[model samples]
Target: MNNSSKAVVSFIVGAAVGVAVGYFLNSDKKDELVGKLRYQADKLKDKWKKKKDQFEDALENELA
Candidate 1:
């Protein structure tokens, strides 16, 4: 993409992040939101690790 397009995308992402931060800072349920986010992140991490291990096992079997 062109420089202008990159700049626009960056600005949009920064604005979105700023808005989310402002919401969390002002909201009373910040702890709940954080807890949910952490739970989801952990779930995703576990899934990724499982998939990675499965892939490695398959590769090892194929090589052997």
Candidate 2:
């Protein structure tokens, strides 16, 4: 809670972030990981769209 403690924590976090960025930038599998992440995002979008459509249909049925 002190200023000195806060400074130390900030330094540690900055170091960790620098290390992570360096690793990702130097990693050979970065592209592969990105592709997988993108694929997962697309699948999630499709799933949400399907759920929304189903919810809308049910709502219309109830109102009818």
Candidate 3:
């Protein structure tokens, strides 16, 4: 898939997984659950950031 399509899929999948994890951990070990969710979120954030930077660099190179 294209980069944009891949990014969207990644976000949607990450959100769904986060929601499921939250639902399952709503009752017990809330702190642990939140930590796990945060970790996953950070990972996704990093992935998106990298992709965005790559796209920006390519655009800049094309414009130069």
Candidate 4:
């Protein structure tokens, strides 16, 4: 297989392993886990937004 095909196969296998691990080690504190994950995701979103704005501002400054 080519590079693209190899990458796709690797991703599928990794995803399958991750699912199996999550299934077997199911956490009892489901709500808490989900909440923490959501909180982290929001924080990441904020960081990305800040970086995007900075990049846009720098580009505008360079042009002007």
Candidate 5:
């Protein structure tokens, strides 16, 4: 929501997109790389979900 937070999210999304594009263009062993990327992405999503909830709660407390 805030500028800094927005910037961070934008950077992350941009990096992921860039990596995906590179991976598609460069990968020879597609299946193995896809599996690894999926696993890593899932891990990141889980971590992000935990942190996002914490940030929301903190923001709510600040507002309250």
Candidate 6:
């Protein structure tokens, strides 16, 4: 698959795994667990977005 598609799939899979682990670890503190997960996910998403933009810019430059 292409780089963008692969990144999306990887993010989805990572999110699923994170949710499962959080649920198992904090069965009674679901809100807290979800909040932490959301924060981490957001940070990861921002990092990925920056990386993707950089990659695209490089590719465009290469083509140009």
Best by TM-score: 2
Off by over 4 Å in 2: none
- lDDT per residue for candidate 1 within 1-64, as digits (tens), equals 9999999999999999999999888998998888999999999999999999999999999999
Which run of 10 residues does model 3 get worst, by summed lDDT? 24-33
Q: Give residue 34's lDDT in candidate 1 (0 to 100).
A: 86
- Pairs that clash in candidate 4: none
lDDT of 5 at 32: 83
Candidate 3 runs further than 4 Å off:
1-28
What are the RMSDs of all candidates, in order?
Answer: 6.1, 1.9, 14.4, 7.7, 14.7, 14.9
Model 4 over residues 1-64: C-alpha lDDT tens digits? 9999999999999999999779756866777878899999999999999999999999999999
Clashes of each: 0, 0, 0, 0, 0, 0
All models: lDDT?
A: 0.97, 0.98, 0.94, 0.93, 0.94, 0.94
lDDT of 2 at 12: 100
lDDT of 3 by residue, 1-64 (tens): 9999999999999999999888777767788878999999999999999999999999999999
Model 2 TM-score (2 dp): 0.77
Candidate 2 per-residue C-alpha lDDT over 23-61 given as tens digits, one digit per residue, 9 for 90 to 100: 998899899999999999999999999999999999999
Better of 4 and 6 by TM-score: 4
| Candidate 1 residue runs with Cα over 4 Å from true position | 1-23
Our model 2 lands, by Cα RMSD against the true structure, at: 1.9
Q: Select the stronger candidate by lDDT from 2 and 4.
A: 2
- Whose lDDT is higher: candidate 4's or candidate 6's? 6
| TM-score, ranked from best to worst | 2, 1, 4, 3, 6, 5
Native-structure RMSD, model 4: 7.7
TM-score of 3: 0.56
TM-score of each model, paired residue for residue: 0.63, 0.77, 0.56, 0.58, 0.50, 0.54
Give every collision pair in model 5: none
